[model samples]
Target: MNGPAQLADLLGMASVQRAGVALLVGSVGLPVIGVVIVGLDIIPVRFAMMHVALLGAAIGMLTGLDPALCGLVACAVAGAGISPLARTPESLSGAMGLLMSLAIAAALLVLSIAGVNASAAFSLLWGSILAVRVQDVLVLAALAVVVPALFWWRRRDLALLLHDRELALVSGVPVRRLTLVLLVLVAVAVAGGIRLTGALLVDALTLLPALAARRLGHSLTAIICWAIGIGITVNLIGFLVALALDLPPGPVLVLAAGAAALAAHLIPERRNTSWHASVH
Candidate 1:
């Protein structure tokens, strides 16, 4: 069959395929939020979430439960734990490192106890979008709405916090509250996103678009908008391409996003020479 014909067949092949594609579209929203937060220097938080997700999956496997649901709970708890540490300059990176080490070690231990092979454990980290359950889709769809809504409603506050937390505090914004809230939201969104790109490649979906968008956009709002557009486009096109090529979706999607980010450099950066001259 031709490309379009093949894609149509994939979509219509089975209920599971249609469900997976639907989930893919919904889950892309998580990466949309990820790009915005990652651009604000919260990349470590996302990484930590991935570790927690792995641990969650291990626990689920050991207990014969749903790994994805367990992962969602683990993500939330880790977010709460990491929030305070994120505020302390001396502890931020250290705490994340500690959590990452512990989480990975615990995951391995649990997998061993459960008699699950290393490859199976590792598969959780890579994920299989085609294997997502209906419940996973529902969770992702809710996060898709909630995460972007929170960011959109508090765009200015988040921008201020990202620009300078101290300044935001001095300006009477609730820095700690907002920071914690954002972290929690990030955790949830990332947990949902792991279903699509897996823990390892989530950044490819999130950061690459933000990085590329920042190169082309003059403002934070513009960057976020462009990132969302880029993210959706990359996921959709990547999914179709993967279907056509009979390849894995996660890596293909990431590579596509990376290519777009690379292409972004071709757009010449705007220099504020006049403003600098005036200031000088």
Candidate 2:
């Protein structure tokens, strides 16, 4: 009887371990997918556009129209800069330099004229998604669905563009039209995710999974699926941790991503010792 009771207890402990492992695996999937969608141009908007003065645009959209459309405006601004500034490599580092300057100047001007609170403007630009409401989740869920679905409907065109823009255009992939669509999709994700993660770190949300997927993902499709799973899991777990620690969700989420990246790197190679044939 004693031995049977001990065995049952051990089995229960094993079950717990299995559950814990599943949760961790799921958490690892969140940022991976979010980043992949961004890389795939499923979400063109980055937290990049949540500038001081841009709050007015978002505010207007929030009040009347859809927040995603407002984000599209910002994405357009980013798109305009990308080819001329960000893609230049030489100019990329400083691309935000002038824009930041202009944005600051404009923000100051608005402050003088409209008397918007400095903190409010800053908050809108940065955002706080730590303790989000259901409404926020709904909006994010919708964008998550719409943006990815659109990309799926036209994955070939996007793949071509990413692989080689000139080739895509030559192949009659409607490069300009699709590029515009992709940028808009990004804006939607950026705007939606900003409520939780803030503006500056949007790239991290979109990039982390891509980094992981690149390592574990054998093919593009597999990479994206795995990436989304990572993004969603990290986000949920990070939010919970942020709640527990009384920390900022944005930074907490980023820290989670960094940890996962480190773990991925630290993970041991599975090659057997017997197979250690050093050709070098």
Candidate 3:
């Protein structure tokens, strides 16, 4: 999914870059989680994570939302009637919250109405890395391109809105429209990433790189570079280790991300560097 233009965009859009990193990590993280569960002698991680991932992916694709977004909506709305949208216009967020809640309710109702096998539905939640097909990779690649580019194309506004919605509004940043688009975008990216990593671990990919970037670098560009580098390392290494050891990839990827985060914390950061600009 990633190409030259998008790579260039990563130089600017921190959020999109962050999601790109998550994409890389989740692509491997889900399988790693499965391996960890197996190693710990817990229940078959595959069944739970796999089913959940599949269900989330299916729902997302069906609804034209990213599968990752679908899971977030379903889980979050099911738990609380919230949109997971903040740092933006409240009105737009409120609308998103309502829509997400309604959508999830519709999905659940459909599942209930169709009398679908709960077990089958669960597969979307947690998925199998061992069985990951080329199609999955292609889908992820496409999302990797679309997700990051979309955010990058609008990064300045997104940064302003997230860090300071009021200021952004006053500055003519289309706060309401931006908020709605961002809310939906976040949902979609999360849903797509979750397909590879599983919901439990997808957040790691989404959040970890940004967190690491906060500490290690000065410019947003530098941070994104580190974030993507960290993500790539985790995904590639985790997958290989899992394959060699006959382990699941999802939990392993999470562990890898965690380890990278810990290392970032422990490592000496660049001397005398400062955070260039706050999100606002």
The candidate scoring highest on TM-score is: 1
Winner of 1 and 2 under lDDT: 1
Candidate RMSDs in Å, in order, are 4.2, 10.0, 11.6
lDDT for 14 in candidate 3 is 53
Instruction: Report the C-alpha lDDT of model 2 over 1-280, residue by residue, as the tens digit.
Output: 2255553553366433343333333333334335434454433224244552264444443356544345445545564554344332335335445555665666556555655456644655565553344455555555656655654676666656555556667889886666555544444445555655567765446666566654565444555666677666665676556545556657877887666666665766443221012111
Q: Quantify how close model 1 is to the true structure by its C-alpha RMSD in Å.
A: 4.2
Arrange candidates by lDDT, descending: 1, 2, 3
What tens-digit string does per-residue lDDT give for candidate 1 at 130-152?
87767777877776677667667
Q: With candidate 2 superimposed using the best TM-score fit, by how many Å does residue 12's alpha carbon deviate from the native?
A: 27
Q: Give per-model TM-scores.
A: 0.86, 0.65, 0.61
Q: What is the lDDT of residue 273 in candidate 2?
A: 22
Q: Alpha-carbon error at 139 in model 3, in Å?
A: 3.0
Runs of candidate 1 exceeding 4 Å displacement? 1-4, 15-28, 88-90, 112-118, 271-280
Q: How large an RMSD does model 3 have?
A: 11.6
Off by over 4 Å in 2: 1-47, 52-101, 131-135, 265-280
